[model samples]
Target: MTDCDFLLVGHGIAGATLADVLRARGHRVLVYDPGQANSASNVAAGLMNPVAGKRFALSWRAEELLPAAAAYYRALEQRYSQSFFTETPIFKIFGSPEEQNAVLARSADRPWGDFVASLTTTDPNLPGVHAPFGGAWLQHGGHVAVRELLAALAAEGHRAGWLRRESFDWTQVQFDSEGATYAGQVRSRHVICCEGAAAVRNPYFGWLPLTPNQGEVLDVECADLSPAQVLNRGAYVVPVGGGRFRVGATYRWPPFAPGITAVGREELAARLTVITDLPFAVVGQRAGVRPAVRDRRPLIGPHPTVPNLSFCGGYGSKGVMLAPRLATLLADWLVGEAEIWPEASVQRYNALQPAGVG
Candidate 1:
């Protein structure tokens, strides 16, 4: 009978970040993952965009999450002696006059104004693209190499005796007065489920309103275009490591499947055609289900029915930016040092529950 402090279900960003945090605090954590599931974090471009394009509004909690995310990634890079995070500028091309005007109008609001640069009349760097009216530069926003970071963390965890390559079985879990037990290996006091979109299957949290979305990305090898900055038109063309670039993300709701479809490919090609004239080769196609919620906020806290079973999933499209600070908050709450915020806490959805029933 082995004992551990935690049994994390998913090896995606949410689980990886939480495990890293707990391990740093000298708590032993055992992560169980099969490595076959398509996690949204794995498909994510990991770009941290402070200013949202649709509404021209600052991302919810961007002020707090952005800096913390940067610091956290940088610290991890230093610790691992690797470069996983890079500070690249995002060039948001103007799609229409209304979009440009919206950005200008938002510039007057202190913090938002501080993040967005003065709207430019023309783009000098990448021409022949859609820049009829030009675009604005987001100063601090950039991309994190999520794939590299996760791989490195998984390796480090294995070396430190904190990660296991196996799928979690609910039948092996036992709940008693002390806490939860799994496979006769009782470690830590609790188990935090970080199983991205799969959290819908969790009996304790299955009731939470989840609106999962299927997202797809194309890895295109474009040798003609070599811009150092990320290009954003309707879709983003983010430069991954080496000569390869990532272009994508078509959001589909409802009948969501993990496989890439011809419709998604057509959608991406159409969007890419609007932004670039260079011929590109589609080397890879990938899809994953994003654990989006009805309210679009993250669900974090202890399970209502079983107190020892906690959760920290439902990051939606902003997992890279939101994970660091939220992980800290969850860690604090688990240690009984702080109370979870009502806005982000799972209690918000629990409020809709019938009285006396979790």
Candidate 2:
């Protein structure tokens, strides 16, 4: 059997980042990626906003994740000789006077004041935009070119002999205290499943509350808008390139199919309507299933009952901002250099099954 220190399933952001971190620490990691259709990383807009929701509250652990993501992605850009991460500000349009007041209130708070600023009454000078109630500018964080980053990571994995571009069969895997053997063709000291929403089907990890979310995005050509920054109302518009902006992300639980639906498209269009008046043509549409959790926190670390088996998924909508930082933390924990963050540890779930039967 081909031997390695780690066997990674699902080469999405979580898996890709973890493999990168471990390899940097001098470990041999093999990644198995079936390349599933509608994987979240492939379809995500890659927007990283420090302030979230209408209340404009700071995102969970924003202080740590923001800098960590920026540094990690920047380093990857240097190593890969490709540009995928862009640091830009987000202009959050207030839908009502109440929302505008909320931003003002939050901005005066201690740490929140560090990243928030109220925009002047003057127009933002963007055509086809309506923000009568004004908006606020989030001074930190940005978006990543997720599709490009994933492709680069996959290339890096292949070049390093760490990536297997095929589906891994759980039924064919045999597990023991020492390690895991897959189809007798691969053996590893630890198996990390970064299967995203598909982990809900994994027998060993299905028991965890991996809530699958169906999200959709629209790729539209809007040259009249500024590509220098992102626009946010009820929805977000991210400038991808070539006068095309990526708009989207409607979250729906259940009916977790990857295909786009008429309802989803209509909802996204309506949300975009509130953000801009400039007419834009919808050039493309995309959708994927994100691995969300009830607590909205990521899952990391070894299984409570299974030896040499670990998990790293459930970054959900925040995968781009969360993956690189958590990946380093997980790698450190795996090599016995540190402990998994309490919120992300799998042990938080009291009902982890001994096997996937649940």
Candidate 3:
């Protein structure tokens, strides 16, 4: 007999979020985490914005995702008796007159009123920031303390005897007539891999088009910038607390190293300068690989042949807002309550791989 209902092979946002959902439904879940120091969830700023880019386009499924994220995190807070998610709006400064006009155009044509909370022009004399063309308030946007969420949720799981503080060995996982076996002892009815960018190293699901990108961000301490909201111009400045903000987030394809580079710092500093004239000191820096995919959609669902083995990853930068909603769906699917979304299902990529491989 299987020792548990589910064996979760990661402890990042994707796995942790799903575990919460499944456990709430009374499923037996065991999580194995290697405690990777540089996991993306550990280093992420955890910002969830509805509108983005120079044109201020609405993010994918913003209407549905924003509310779901807010509700889920709020529930998590009540469960943990801790505070983490903050509903801070984003003040996206316009770069140029043309860009300002572009936003106005988007607001008129698109239903931007739903996500673009407010829009206004700059006074030019505005202190600290260089917003001559003005900015907009992105509504229903906020940042989740991902590190806190992971830590708190892990603690909860550990207390409930569902969290294992160790790396999962894929070689030790065996699928047979009974179910999935791991470490030659523990047996599970199902195993879901949520290994983030590390999934690229997975032999079974590695065949998926996962483009792990290296992202670097700087934690800065600037007393002059606004802590009430996030500043998005050339780069983002998210308030971490008193006089400190998380900034930068350069995306480099084929990420080389785990350490922060001089080039990344310089590039971020250049953008930070454009955002404001106030001097700020870099208090800390972090780097991690985002589990992004070529299709830019989430990777989910069970293996084609091995029904007990599944995956839930490729969330990339939107893990905070995306994971919970997708996890709910996956949980429903696991219980035979619903089917997986086609776009995120592993079967969608089955044709590209050799027969029988997930």
- In model 1, residue pairs whose N, Cα or C atoms come closer than 3 Å (at least 3 residues apart or on different chains), thus clashing, are 3-186, 3-187, 4-187, 4-188, 5-188
TM-score of candidate 3 against the unseen true structure: 0.96
lDDT of 1 by residue, 78-102 (tens): 9989998888888788887888887
The global C-alpha lDDT for each of the candidates, from Candidate 1 onward, is 0.82, 0.86, 0.86
| Candidate 2 lDDT by residue in tens digits, 279-302 | 888888999999999899999988
The TM-score values for the models, in the order shown, are 0.94, 0.96, 0.96
Q: Number of clashing residue pairs in every model?
A: 5, 3, 0
Q: Worst 10-residue stretch by lDDT in candidate 1?
A: 349-358
| Candidate 3, 1-358: lDDT as tens digits | 4389989989999999999899889988888998887899998999998888886778777788889999999998988899889998888998888888889878754557888877887643445878888888887889999998899988777787789888888988889766688977898989999999999888788888888899999998889786888889877888988889999698988838667888888888889999888999988889888999887889899877765888999999989989889999999998889998897787888866666564
Residue 107 CA displacement from its true place in model 1, Å: 1.7
